[model samples]
Target: MADALLIIDMQTGLYDGPEKPFERERVLATLNLLIQRARHAGAPIFYARHTGPAGSPIEAGSPLWQLWHELEVDESRDHLFNKTRPSCFLGTNLEQQLRAAQVKDLVIAGMKTQFCIDTTCRVAVELGFSVVLPEDGHTCMDTPALKAEAIIEHHNATLAGAFVKRTCAAEVRF
Candidate 1:
């Protein structure tokens, strides 16, 4: 299966709050490394930015909707798709872009572990694409009741080896 990298919602909005996500620094370091590795290997890289409705923090065309400054974005080299919902495949050109790139295996990593990352991973598998999830690549903020680490672990436990294969950051070859 040909592989592609889908980096979803690593936007300013996700990082601009009082509470930061668990393992955020690690997520950024690992995700950034994966991006570089993917580019070096000539794999198709897709950046999925969330486009919230009007009045939302990440509203379409808003500054918060933009990718963080640290993310390496080259419009001429990578594909960018705006998603209206949590799942990247819903109401976006993601599938078409994947098909055009002849991508059959997806390596996904991004924000809000139980939302976009989870939804997209399951949907991709259901849609017949192989999925690979780097264990340290995604994260979310902690709620008042639950810790971010626990939420991340819970999702990882639920998704890994079932909906997707869990691998480490440096171990991901493509």
Candidate 2:
């Protein structure tokens, strides 16, 4: 019945790209707020850094693969891991780890709203974990078909009902 915080792919390179994620500062601020609140509530914090192929933005051990410098993380207490797929559960031991820690609920937030956030939230529910997706806590860069804001809006609406409990960062409860 415990809740855990899963921060996915909020890496430095994502922000250093040509187009920064939409509402970059807002998302970071919201994430920091969530981090502080989760810490106070004694919730387990999990950081999932996405690893990409060599020479890619998020290549393993590369500076781009590192978490955003502005994001707050306490390595001493928070769990850290890497993933190679869009869904954190795929190609990762996230599920087993959460189950082992008795975490049945999750607060998922980070970058690439249309990909990692969307995929992870859906998969988390399928795995039987209740998920709270903070609408303003995840973001992405603009694409040819849609603006970053539009993508965030679309995903938030798309995943709001059955897939995840949708809420803003301020309303999310640990």
Candidate 3:
């Protein structure tokens, strides 16, 4: 089965804040490498932008809503879609597009590991797509109850065996 890559909510506003995600620089570098590798492997790439309500950081049409300038996005070859909810499939055509391309294995990476990343991984498996979640590719800010490192570690362990295949960005193959 061919594999596809899904980059979720990697917006400029998410990183330009006081509280940044765990290993922000490393994660961005990893994601860019993943993108390059996927392109070389002829894998389809999909970018999902989260649209928050107006006045919010990532409100639609706002500068913050734009994808991070550092990301390796090629509009001519990649697909971009907007979503509001945590799950990328909930209100988007992501599933349909993946199915149309005959893609059954999905490699997901991007921001807010505790929210969009977590939700998308679970839903992708339920949708019959085998998901490869790069353990170090997605990240988030610390929460009141837990540090970002703990959250990322927790989700990696929790989602590893059943929901998705967990691996580091360097170990992930397109």
Candidate 4:
């Protein structure tokens, strides 16, 4: 089965806001490496952008809605999906796109470790695709209940080998 890299919601709004999470640079670096690796391996790279309603922080045309500049998005080579919900498949054509590409496996990486990342991972698994999550490829803001690092670690530990198989950016193989 063919595999594609699914980069979820790595938009400017999530990383540049007041409640920014630590280790963002590290996550971006890992994502960049994964992009390069996916390209070199001839795997399709797909990006998901979250578009909030009008007046919302992530509203369309807002700087926060754009993908981080560190990862260059080549429209010709990559597929971009704009989502209004947490799960990329909820109201979007992600499933159609993946099916069109004949993709059977997905390598997911992106923001809000427990929300968008976790939701998409579960949905992807339910959709019958093999899900691969790079341990350090996703992050979230610190909450009163848990630190950002703890949230990330908890998700990685819990999701690994269950909802998704946890792998590091360097260990991912096409």
Candidate 5:
């Protein structure tokens, strides 16, 4: 089976935000570079968008639900899936698509470090796929209790090599 790159929740809302994620530009650069690498390697690349409830920033058909402008999506090859839940497989055809592509491993990246990224990585493991989380490719906004940096660090430390191996974006292989 082949490996696929699973990018979760890298949408416009995360970029154009009242509560901005730390180093969004850096995260985008890392993600874009890796995405290019995956494309060159002929690996499957799936982009998941979180469609939040109505009135939320990412409500369906809104500008915020769109993919970040800088993140180029190739309609001819790459796939984009909409999800209401954190885990991309839930209520989506992600699992079926992966299985169809013979994907044995998932190299993951994207937004909201403590939520969608973490949940998707864990669920991928539970569903019997090896997961490689790119440390530099996911980000989150600061909360009232924790700084964005601390949240990123905590998730990296806890989730890194926990349910999946954590590698730098440049080092992740599809």
Candidate 6:
């Protein structure tokens, strides 16, 4: 089955503020490597950008809604999906795009360990696509009760066996 890499909600708004989400440099580095590998393997790349209502940081026309500069998104080869919700498949044409690309397996990498990343992984699996999660490729904001590293570790450990096939960036295969 053909595979596509779904990069979910890796926008500036989530990582450019005074208090950013997770390890910006590490996550970006891992994602950059994933992008290179996926591109070389001929795997389709899809980006999901989160948008919110007016006045929100993630407002459609706001700079925060844009993907981080490091991504260097290539319009020619990458598919872009703008979404208002956490799950990329919710209220978006992501399903259609995947179907059109004949993608049966989804390799996910992006932001918010408890939000967009987790939601998309669950939804993709429920939608019958084999899901691959690069362990070091996703991150989240720190909560009052937990640190960012703890949250990421918790999710990776718990979600590894059931929700998705969790592996390191280097282990991700098409």
lDDT (10s digit) by residue, model 2, range 78-146: 998999999999988899999998999899999889899999999999999999988889999999999
Q: Tell me which residue pairs clash in candidate 5.
A: none
Estimate, for each residue in 1-174, the C-alpha lDDT of model 6 and write its tens digit: 228898888888887877787788988988988888888888899999999999998899799999988885788878987998889998998998898988987889889888888888888888988888888999888889999999889888877878788888888876
Q: Which residue pairs overlap in candidate 1's backbone? A: none
CA RMSD (A), model 4: 1.3
Residues 29-131 of candidate 5 have per-residue lDDT tens digits of 9989888988988999999999989898789889989998898678789989999988888999999999999998888888889999889989999999888
Assess candidate 1 and give its TM-score to the true structure. Answer: 0.95
Question: Which candidate model has the greater TM-score, 4 or 6?
Answer: 4
Give the candidates in order of lDDT, highest first.
3, 2, 4, 1, 5, 6
Q: Candidate 4, residues 1-174: lDDT per residue as tens digits? A: 228999988888887788886698888888888888888888999999999999998998888899878776778879997999889899998999999988988999988898999999999999999899999899999999999999999999988987898887888876
Q: Kindly report which residue stretches of model 3 are placed more than 4 angstroms away from their true locations once superposed.
A: none
Report the poorest 10 consecutive residues by lDDT, candidate 1: 15-24
Error of 5 at 116 (Å): 0.2
lDDT of 3 by residue, 22-111 (tens): 899999999999999999999999999999898887888899899999999999999999999999999899999999999999999998
Model 1 spans with C-alpha error above 4 angstroms? none
User: Which model scores highest in lDDT?
Assistant: 3
Error of 5 at 82 (Å): 0.6
lDDT of 1 by residue, 46-159 (tens): 999989889998898898898877888778989988988889999887888898888888999989898899999999998888999888999999888789889888988899
Who is ahead in lDDT, 3 or 6? 3
**TM-score of every prediction relative to native:** 0.95, 0.96, 0.96, 0.95, 0.95, 0.95
